[model samples]
Target: MTVRMFMGDARVDAIAPDDRGLAYGESLFETMRIHRGDIPWWDAHMARLTHGTQRLAMPLPDATRMYAEAMALLDGADGVLKLQLTRGGGVRGYAANSDAAPFWMLSMHPLPNRIDSLDTIWCEITLASQPRLAGLKHGNRLEQILAANEVRAANADEGLMCDGAGRVIAATSANFFALIDGHWQTPVLDACGVAGVMREWVLAQVDAHVTSLKPSDVECADAVFLCNAVRGILPVQRLGARAWPRTHPEIRALQAALAQSHPGFEPLLEAS
Candidate 1:
């Protein structure tokens, strides 16, 4: 549980007690995979973080300093790096003044053991319809927390969550994709869910289509998978009582494609 705190350009021992991020989850975060002491998709992660800061009207810490600190923390280690940026300490209220300096933190954590396959469940708690915070990795994750609780209760690897209108959004902590009609299809995230970095890469590699999807659409697909920057790509082997064979070519091809693009996934792809 080692952590390296960053408040603007200066490192700190602890966050201010009145920080808005702790008070009301007013923060944004990026969870990335470290490979050979580098983040393969660093540009994408930074771009999304910048977009989120602008969209939320929050100030950003110095990017160069943050990158240097992150690299120092990695120290040639391969694992997960989590960066969190908050609106800093602010007065207690809903309306945030525009003069607050941002507080950020960078932490390193061990990667979860790689699972060859995943068993996901359709969560009962639906994602709330909030187009304003749709694609940002904001810290207001009570929904994901609740959905993950459902996953824990079901003893499943992950949980698939749908929007209030029954449109499949994403997994609790990752993006969802299915092989439908011979093409990869993922739910459009205009209404909810965080658009994951690895999901973006997979979409670009496969020319994946973004469309409205239903639970039945996923259930009847040729293959389904969940992806995140930390875990690369995970093929879904079982969803509730439904099962997918390990020999699905589309899934295999995706693994190959990912390995070709990123060396971190090569070992998983070879084993697959």
Candidate 2:
């Protein structure tokens, strides 16, 4: 794993232990798909990161310098790049140091093994409703952590989560969508869930409805799929007792379209 750490604009070997990100989860992160030392959706990822920083009042890093470091870390490899931005180090208290420099890090990870289809479950861990934090990729991810643990223990590929009102929100690490009546419907992220970068691209590519959805809606839908920046498009073959076609024709078309649009997903398209 390649890593580059920084404090504001200066390079560093490691982060301070008293960093707010470590103490209070005061941070934001983005996991990008790197293709041949480049991030095709760099602009989109930076947009979200900027949004989160503004919302949280955290100092933003220089985007140009960050991009250079990201490319340096990737070093022409096809993998995943994770950027974590924190509120910098401070004393042992909740009160933030207004003068503290922002702390950030970039780490490179290999992409997980690709599977053509997925089997998932509805997890018991429900997402907490926090509209202010909704749609941001913050460091506080205990909800997703618990849900992912359940999926791992069940030997499933992933798990779908719901908000307190029982409205389907998203999967543990990805945004979910269902095909119903020849239309694509995804859960609205106004109440919870991170708005994934890949989900943004897909919505831009197709006419999708952002609406409130229930588990029954997913079960009754014609097809279901999950998308994230790391995994372009994933066909969900089974969720609980309900099952879908391993290769839904519509899903294949979507995957092909994504592969054509994103170079990182070309391998997934070839597997189909």
Candidate 3:
């Protein structure tokens, strides 16, 4: 991993110990797929970031300068780029310090390991309903962390999480989609869950529904997939004892379509 830090626009050596992001999780982030030093979904990520900053009352970084630095950090490498924006340092309290500058970091990480198909488990950790924060990629992710731990303990690549009402929300780290009766359906993010960039792209590409999902819906679906900006589209081969075909036709078709539209996901199409 490689990182560069900035406070507002100037370079920074380290995050202050009292940074709001560390003190109270007062921050947001966007993880993007970098292909040959360029981000194909830059616009989508930026839009989400802008929306998040507005909601949280945080300052938006200078995009042109950020991109230039990101490319320099990527150095023509194909990998993951994580952009984190914090509300800057605080003075040991929850009250807003309106004068503080925004603190941001850009880091590059190696590509995620390729999994032919994901083996998943249904996590017992339920997401809390917080509509105000729903659909935003905020820094506080204790729920996902706990759920991912459950997945690891179960020896599954990912875990399906649900809200307290038992409505399926999403996977530990990605958006969830299932094929039901020839239609693509994903859980609604009105209550909780991050609305991923790839999910937005997929929704635009296919006729899909954003609605409530039951566990039975997932179990009985024709096929399932997990998506994130970093990992284009990941087919789910097994969830608990239920198994889906390794060669799901819709999965392959979607992957191909995504690759055609985004150069970053092109390699995934051939492999899928």
Candidate 4:
């Protein structure tokens, strides 16, 4: 992976030992899909990052400079780009230094292998309801890390997470969606989960409802899928004993629509 580190506007070599992002997890990050050296959803990612900065009261890095540097690092190659913004170095306590320059970094990596379907398991780890940090991609991710480990141990491709109340929230790394009673419904993330860019686009494209769901609702749905910025849409084939043997026509249609809007996902459709 190729990476560039920055402190406010100036380039930097390494992260400071006392960086608040490292010490206290005061950071936000966005992972984007790059197609032919261009980030089609760059604006959307930045908008989410901006929202995170506002919530955390951290300074945002210059968008213009970030874009230029990201493109330069890509060098016309297709890959994944990650942008991370931290509160920078701080004093040895929980108190933040508002005047300190923010630390940020941009890194480029090879795209992950394409996946057409998912074999998911119900994760035992229940997401804590933190309304203030619910939708932001903040750096504190112990829950996801543990859930991902569970998925790996279970030999599942993904894991579905719920809140303490047993309300289905999302997948370990993607947003969850279900088609029930002829309507598409996704779990509301007002109190948890990352508000994924692809989820927003899909909601705008279809007459989908953002509401609460339960495990039984997902198991009994006509169809189920997972979505994120990198992987446009992926049908869920199995969740433990329940299996969706056939791909729903609506899922194919949405995949076609996503390919039309974002050429980066066209390859995923072909692979599917």
Global lDDT for candidate 2? 0.91
Q: lDDT by residue for model 2 over 175-269, one digit each (tens)?
A: 98899989999999987999999999889878999999999999999999999999898989999989986668878888888888876786354
Q: Which ten residues in a row have the lowest lDDT in candidate 4?
A: 263-272
Residue 235, candidate 1: C-alpha displacement in angstroms? 0.6
Candidate 4, residue 187: the lDDT equals 93
Q: State the number of backbone clashes in model 1.
A: 0
Worst 10 residues of 1 by lDDT: 263-272
Q: How accurate is candidate 1 locally (lDDT)?
A: 0.87
- The worst-scoring run of ten residues by lDDT in candidate 3 lies at 263-272
User: How far in Å is the alpha carbon of 256 misplaced in model 4?
Assistant: 0.4
TM-score preference between candidates 3 and 4, better one: 4
Candidate 1 structure quality by residue, lDDT tens digits, 39-78: 8878899999999999898888988888888888886878
Residues 1-272, candidate 4: write the lDDT tens digits: 78999998999999999999999999999999999989999999999999999998888989999988888888777889999899999889887855788999999888888877889999999999999999999999999999999999999999999999999999999997899999999999989999999998999999998999999999999999999998889999999789998778899899899999888887344334
**lDDT tens digits, residues 180-268, model 3?**
99999999999899999989989988899989999999999999999999888889989988998664888888888888877667534
Greater TM-score among 1 and 4 belongs to 4
Off by over 4 Å in 4: 267-272
lDDT of prediction 3: 0.89
**Error at 165, model 3, angstroms:** 0.2
TM-scores of the candidates in the order shown = 0.96, 0.97, 0.96, 0.97
What is the lDDT of every predicted structure here? 0.87, 0.91, 0.89, 0.92
